[model samples]
Target chain A: MTDTWLTSLITDTPQQGYELAITLSRRGVKYTQPDMDTLKKLRPEYANSAEGLTAASHVIAVNFQTVAAANNYWRG
Target chain B: MTDTWLTSLITDTPQQGYELAITLSRRGVKYTQPDMDTLKKLRPEYANSAEGLTAASHVIAVNFQTVAAANNYWRG
Candidate 1:
């Protein structure tokens, strides 16, 4: 439903964000770790604060979804 | 799981950010609008950048889940 939106949202993150990848794999989900190039463009504010990582966390191409989960999930 | 993380993530936003509320309902999801107090503490970097509103879009307590989805969902 949100093809264009998804395209813009899709991005990568630093290895530091890979912790999210490890967490997701444990929960039975499919995802890829974003490369450094993409992570550089990412706004650090959205990255995970819980793990004390300066780089942006996981990133992907999401279709139509509510912001509720993301809203809370991004917080530290 | 992540009870401490969930508590920290839950927050609020200005009425302008309520647009996310409408999106979630359209998608058959349940969510709440955060009070201004909660939104204030929210780091602006995590707030919805796509929308003109500077306020945080949405906030809720989330259990252990894949960060991949939230990683993409939070952008814009």
Candidate 2:
């Protein structure tokens, strides 16, 4: 569910569970708690997979960083 | 600057400032201060247009809300 939502944020379309997970992983996206919960629900094996962790870090560095920066821009 | 970054987040590609402004408008994305600043820099005309405000609200509703929810999940 969360994967689909996140994928839609990027792709503007809903994707299958596994496909979205793979996509997020391949993109090196960070995982928020909701994302992790959703991943565990949808595919527990992939939730903590090597690829997933890598993607999570990447997401934090790239996407979340941007979001945080945007927030900072507003707070200031 | 902000629009391009946000677009890159979604498209994974950099787009023309004008093009990205139009795209975000159509998508109904919400604007953070950074987004507004970037939009003003790229195309001030579009920043407060009906479409832009709508998009900004939409973005906040759909995207920011998710991010906030994810944050809450983590905080818990």
Candidate 3:
């Protein structure tokens, strides 16, 4: 959330990179929906549904793709 | 996490698509780290750090890109 955090996206390992990706994704949600109460209230609507859960995975895969690209798929 | 949840990635609106992306990202973390206690224990390490937070945004942007593509950026 802080501009100061805007440094290198470079991660030492894929595992670390993946964890970072998840962190980024989670924070994105927090930023989008700042209200914890509202987030919780909305959770049930999506959390219990199959469509909602699948949608979540789709986002994660997309995020992972970006992280992997940033890390050059960790080929190095 | 269930195979049965697999279905069309298509979404009606950008807002809905975005919400789905967030869900996918979240579910990814859950799938990766099933242990809630471990996940909670690791939270502070990244949640409080500036770099961690930014990393989170980076991933979110990446995810948004994918969702946008799926929704054709809602041009219709």
Q: Residues A1-76, candidate 3, lDDT per residue (tens digit)?
A: 2233323345789888777656556657576556577556666655686866665555556666656765667896
CA error at residue B11 for candidate 2, angstroms: 25
lDDT of each: 0.27, 0.34, 0.60
TM-score of model number 1, chain B: 0.20
Q: Which stretches of candidate 1 lie over 4 Å from their true place?
A: A1-58, A61-76, B1-22, B25-33, B48-76
RMSD value for candidate 3: 14.5
DockQ metric for all predictions: 0.05, 0.02, 0.08
For A1-76, candidate 1 gives per-residue lDDT tens digits of: 1211122222233332334333222111111112334333443433434432311122111111222344443444
**Candidate 1 local lDDT, B18-76, one digit each (tens):** 22333332232212434555545542433223121111111110111223243344354
lDDT by residue (tens digit), candidate 2, A6-60: 5242332211221233444344433434466654475434332323222232332
Worst 10 residues of 1 chain A by lDDT: A55-64
What is candidate 1's local distance difference test score? 0.27
Q: Which pairs, if any, clash in model 2? A: A28-A55, A29-A55, A30-A56, A30-A59, B28-B55, B29-B55, B29-B56, B30-B56, B30-B59
Candidate 3's C-alpha runs over 4 A off are: A1-29, A32-76, B1-6
Best DockQ goes to which candidate?
3
Descending-lDDT candidate ranking: 3, 2, 1
lDDT of 3 at B41: 96
